[model samples]
Target: MSGLAILLLAAGASSRMAGRDKLSEEVDGQPLLSLMCRRAALTGLPVYVTVPSDAHPRTGLTGTATTVPVPDAAEGMAASIRRGIAALPANTEGVMIVPADMPDLETQDLMHVAAHFHGGDGPILRATSENGQAGHPVLFPKRSFDDLCELSGDQGARALLKRDKVQYIALPARHAITDLDTPEAWAAWRAANG
Candidate 1:
């Protein structure tokens, strides 16, 4: 895990949550952002969380995980990813990017992806549903960092995953596809799994 870093993306404005800040919302008595950061820490890998400057004070993320502030978070996910990537250590071999809204994303799923990342020229490992739908916590090798840095707008690294040269490991986990972006989605998740 020394070569791999976990970048927790928490910089979004949560526009679909009906004025609510999804990261501050509680799941099992813990804030969702804090829970995700803790889970990322469990792998013993370096964890960096990207939060909007305004949200940094209330994120409740400390300790081994570093908080990266994206002043232009409103620009979209690319801004957060750029900030996180820019903060990475020069020796980092890869990065696992996980969204803070994925409430059901388990530590085991992250560990599984991290464990599968071989150093040097390795494939992008993405968590997928049982039916092969790609999901969050995508692992990108150092070779792809440049491409990731060039991203703009709301686009993520999904475009990089489609490259013919890029190999892929599809980890099967139902929770990987579950994200609580809206109030209804959050309520539904809480109702089903709380």
Candidate 2:
């Protein structure tokens, strides 16, 4: 074990997708949330998945990952972030925060990030596009857990990241930044990548 855990944020309302729950959307015959969880699990790290509630459909698809229901998930990304961080195992020394909506993020992409985490102490590891655009699956050391838990609104950890030293790890193409939120985005991603 890398003394690390994966936090898959799936509590978002996906309001941008109208009535569609983007996490529940199909990705290669499985729910996007399920695929993400499986990918995270493949890293052999503990995974904590946040959902709107225990009854939400996402909870059913979590598979081996732990389910953390954020009753205040409507309050936005921070609610899930705060809740997910608290749910990680007691032995976790670092966390890789992955948004569940990025269909292009494969198991290898996650492993690439996990491979860079060095004993839970060092500069934060943030995945970047091949062209150097800063993006998702940020790996934070144990020292930053409090700051992450203190985050608010839908901004996620952008504020905490700005205050810390972040080392960027380049992933192929726009894999780091390709998060599909709206129907149009999904359609375009499907068309462009298919």
The regions of model 1 sitting more than 4 angstroms off are 164-173
lDDT of 2: 0.90
Model 2 Cα shift for residue 159 (angstroms):
1.1
Q: Which ten residues in a row have the lowest lDDT in candidate 2?
A: 113-122
Per-model lDDT? 0.83, 0.90
Backbone clash tally (model 2): 0
TM-score of every model versus the real structure = 0.93, 0.97
Residue range 81-150, candidate 1, lDDT tens digits: 9999999999999999999888888888899888888774777778777677878778888988898899
Model 2 Cα lDDT, one tens digit per residue, 1-194: 46888899999889999899998888889998998999888888888999999998889999998999999999999999999888887778999999999988888988898888876668899999999999988999998888988989999998888888899999999989999999999989889977
Quote the positional error of residue 91 for candidate 2 in Å: 1.9
Over 4 Å off in model 2, which ranges?
none
- lDDT over C-alpha atoms for residue 35 of model 1: 86
